[model samples]
Target: MTLVSGPTGGGSIDDFELFYARRALGRLRSRLGRQGLLDLLAEDIGKGEAFLRESAGLSGGSFNVGATVLATRGSTAGEFVAWMDKAFADENVLLAAQPEHYVMAGQPDGAVHIVENIGPHVCSFYLGSWSAEALAWAADAEELLPEAEFPHKKASNLFLADGTVVGRVLIQFGDTDDGFTSSLTVYLPTACPESVLEHHLRHFAVEFRNWIVASTTARA
Candidate 1:
């Protein structure tokens, strides 16, 4: 599958589904911390990539893989939810025309939302360290599960969200890498029209980028 980055300057993951499959690692971090993020990555980044690919309904081949976890320097745990809440959906954040398609879910305790965007869902999460016990449950196939028809090496894949694009993203992969592969996808329930999906996606991407740039500057 071709890989792409959301817009570098501005835009949502409008037609993002075309070239990018996305996931949020920060949810795990909310419960597990920075180490939690690392543990999951170490155990099964490949699995996650495969899951995204299948779910996004993209053609399969090779994909570029990269991730960005932004944090607000010096914010207490209590401040996290509010900060991310706005990031997910606020005047400056959420940018969808049909409001129903891009719903924002606030964080609950340390657990973040997984998403239910059948019609409209925008999952909110925070990024940090990794969790050690993040063993490869997501990556592991059950003993009773069916096996693949033909086995092939795992390959690198890029993760993206609404508004992000695959234009330059695929051009960045190096070589000789593999991790996981699975086809966990979503069916439309609250599925919005393509144009609405694009708008919400772009909103999600633009909001995320603004937060990242601001947070980075604060840290610097």
Candidate 2:
């Protein structure tokens, strides 16, 4: 795969998924405090398919990956949820949350049009919101279990421009004593390099952190 330079003013990970992911994890650990980070891991452990195992399950030219971030400290779940409501309704905010080479636009019918430039080829998908059951599943406290009053969750299934189902994404948030945590999962059929998945993970880290900070700041 051809590795293109990412956006200016951003550290681009062209082919260093492991290195970048480790660094991102360390940074998150430092920022969230070791105990706070441990809280995240405690929740993540033994949950559903292991990350690499899930990645290996990809077949027929498709793959999936996810990233989790301790988005904010000292904010209520309701506050974060309200912020997300406004943020998702704003196209600009949604666009700002994406990494380089990924563009998202909202449709009139509440679907999202996504264009991804994955180096070797461009892929387009229309993402429609998940049903209530799916949303609850995505917001489950455990990876593969459902939880009540999960605080917030937004999810969608990806479809080709022609309407063939291709993949899905889930963004879920939960409340903690420290604040809110976010888990972002992306599944796609692009069959891109593993580095691409890592890049998106880092993308989730940076963008969600900023948005969480913004949310708290606004409340303050």
Candidate 3:
């Protein structure tokens, strides 16, 4: 309810809004009771999922939203990814690293795709202009939609090479000299709430900056 549902310039996501959606949903579950909440979710799930394609434009608008975070100090992209991998490993979250898959029209085998630019100097929307990883990922763009599950919390998504939906993590990193200028983008399906995706993007930005600090300190 607190989300900037309409539109905003630069499309920056808010970390506070990210947490608010989850907390609000939790409160709704408490107030409505589990069954009540589940019933509502169940109803929306079928409708939202069924017409996901029809709502593609709307979802695309939602997906455009993003956030940026600066590292406390300069570092390599590998260091950033290392910290991210370990963070999720500790949480026991599923990961699909370097994910790829052929996208078929009209199938739940997979419905949508999202890209996370570790630190976005290059825009993913641009063809033949994105960073190396993005360009490499683009090589298969026509044959398949990169396999990825939108993460609910902070951490790079594990882009599934096998394109398996078994996991919901799609991690991508940008190879930046300073690492302080990294960025992330989430390509979400219409079935997923736009606001929630925005929330996740915010979480990803905040956590990434935090990891930068943690990793930097540990090495010092």
Candidate 4:
């Protein structure tokens, strides 16, 4: 696959990968057959959904899995990111924060779960520290995701009002016809499990909601 590199702000990770994957898949499908492509894609989608569900310990079995695949099939990276952003925002359980990149922090443990939009059908999780131990753990984990090695940058340690280390989100922005376009790159520790990570995300969401309620009450 050709790695298109320029300013990081030009597109999302999902958009890059999805565009290439879909194109390749399309060519293969045409040569093979539509049913052949659908069958292969269906299996890939199922595996992806299962991995997410098992790793994240999500209760609502594949709520938006189908939708996610459909949107990603032939869409642009920018378009997929928009849909993903909206989909994530609409989830009631996870408190969505686009601090810069889409970061969902766990309230109870203060662990930050990092998610990145890669093209239409691909998204990535930032494992903490990128240490040998962390990579090993991820390898042994239930979800089998493609891994990339990026150079590490010193991240500012951030704390919530409650004294949790949620880290900082870094977003790259570019000029687009839609106004300003931005994509988030998240920093997180590699030690967290999908279950624990998700739990913290839910806790943070609830806490944020409560804070909003309390502030509104005080104003009232």
Candidate 5:
């Protein structure tokens, strides 16, 4: 990731992601406790998400891992539908639209399981605090924006149960304060195109699972 200045004086997503990843990895390795690792990863993911969101000119919403987890504590699969229904029952617009500025202002895009370990056990992931306005507007206008123009589409700030993974590339469309932003997050599992659920499971699940296992083993 080369650190190049965009038309603006700010650094590009590539620069930020690289810097963020290095810092995050360092912090992850430095921590000797599971809680410390989770905190560091959450903070790093928030910073990375903010960088990409701001660099791409989207309104960078607040980044929160705990908030996301708490929001979905009892949520079931596809529960976003129910959540959105209750959230927007009075509003005419969808939650995806005006995401940052809407009622569910601080809520993330959605929650997905990073991995299902040992059958019922699962590691959940949350990525919010980035804007999706550009994708939402683009869809309505039938216009397409380049990946560089929209960071959310090019990259995602991943938060696992235990470590963090950045850049999960996916062509996602949704509405936000800016309109409809179309872009991908940076750290995805692989180059293969998969659903959000599958992407998390493949890329972040194992890493987090291993971390948890190691932490438990060390404590024991």
Candidate 6:
């Protein structure tokens, strides 16, 4: 997989890995056979759902991973936030957010169903609920009280069918003179491998960039 330099100075995944991950299913479709592939995916999705349901009753820690990006020119925090509100509320927009093996469905009840095909035999799926919050400003850490902050923030607390908190995805944005700066943080189970965490961070980078672009092109 090709590596792209991250905003925080670490090596991050490039479009190669993202593209490959989304196409894994297509690559194996012929070999698995249509029925065989469906059966396999159904079994996996069922098992994954069951695992989430059972694990919902248990409490465990998670590894916090995040990625930040700067969107310069032709965008503002307010506009992005408005776009997000509609995107999360509309199932079509949600489905169009990432476009392929990354499936997102926004429900009438305001929750989202997210599924990602990470590899030929592996998929990560979950149901989550979103909320808005106010977080302290990261740029003004030294000040006694940093008035400069990300005023627009939304976070999704990932859960199981039974409402057990499995993880969280926090998205925050602040307006800049040129455009806006946004960041996304994900909390996943500690048992998850480093590669999974890295992939998620890179996923954020790609997905959010797409959303930002969409926001700009949206009919006003």
Provide TM-scores for the models: 0.24, 0.59, 0.36, 0.21, 0.22, 0.65
Off by over 4 Å in 1: 1-108, 112-190
In candidate 5, stretches whose alpha carbon ends up further than 4 angstroms from where it belongs are 1-121, 132-144, 147-155, 161-163, 166-187, 191-220
Top candidate when judged by TM-score against the true structure: 6
Ranking by lDDT: 6, 2, 3, 4, 5, 1
Summarize candidate 3's per-residue lDDT along 32-139 as a digit string, tens digits: 643453354554433433343334434443333344444434776566666654543331111112111011111132222322222211001111112234335324
Give the alpha carbon lDDT tens digit for every residue of 1-220 in model 2.
6457654544435536745754665455447653453354443432311332333345453546555655567897778778876776665566444433234567787777665433233455577854575455344434432345354667766666556655567776777777766767766544446666676666667667767777888778
> How close to the true structure is residue 124 of candidate 5, measured as C-alpha lDDT?
33
Whole-model Cα lDDT per candidate?
Answer: 0.30, 0.57, 0.38, 0.34, 0.33, 0.58
What tens-digit string does per-residue lDDT give for candidate 4 at 1-220? 5447775666677777766764664455346443443454555544533444343333321111100011112223333334333433332223222211233333233234433222222122332332234334223323222222112211223333333333333322233333322233332333324343444344334433333333334335
Model 5, 43-63: lDDT tens digits are 544554444333223313222
Better of 2 and 6 by lDDT: 6
lDDT winner, 2 or 4:
2
In model 6, how many backbone clashes occur?
Answer: 0
Tens digits of per-residue lDDT, candidate 1, 64-107, equal 22222223334332233334334544422332212222222333
Worst 10 residues of 3 by lDDT: 120-129
The positional error of residue 135 in candidate 6, measured at the CA in angstroms, is 8.8
**Candidate 2, TM-score vs. the true structure?**
0.59
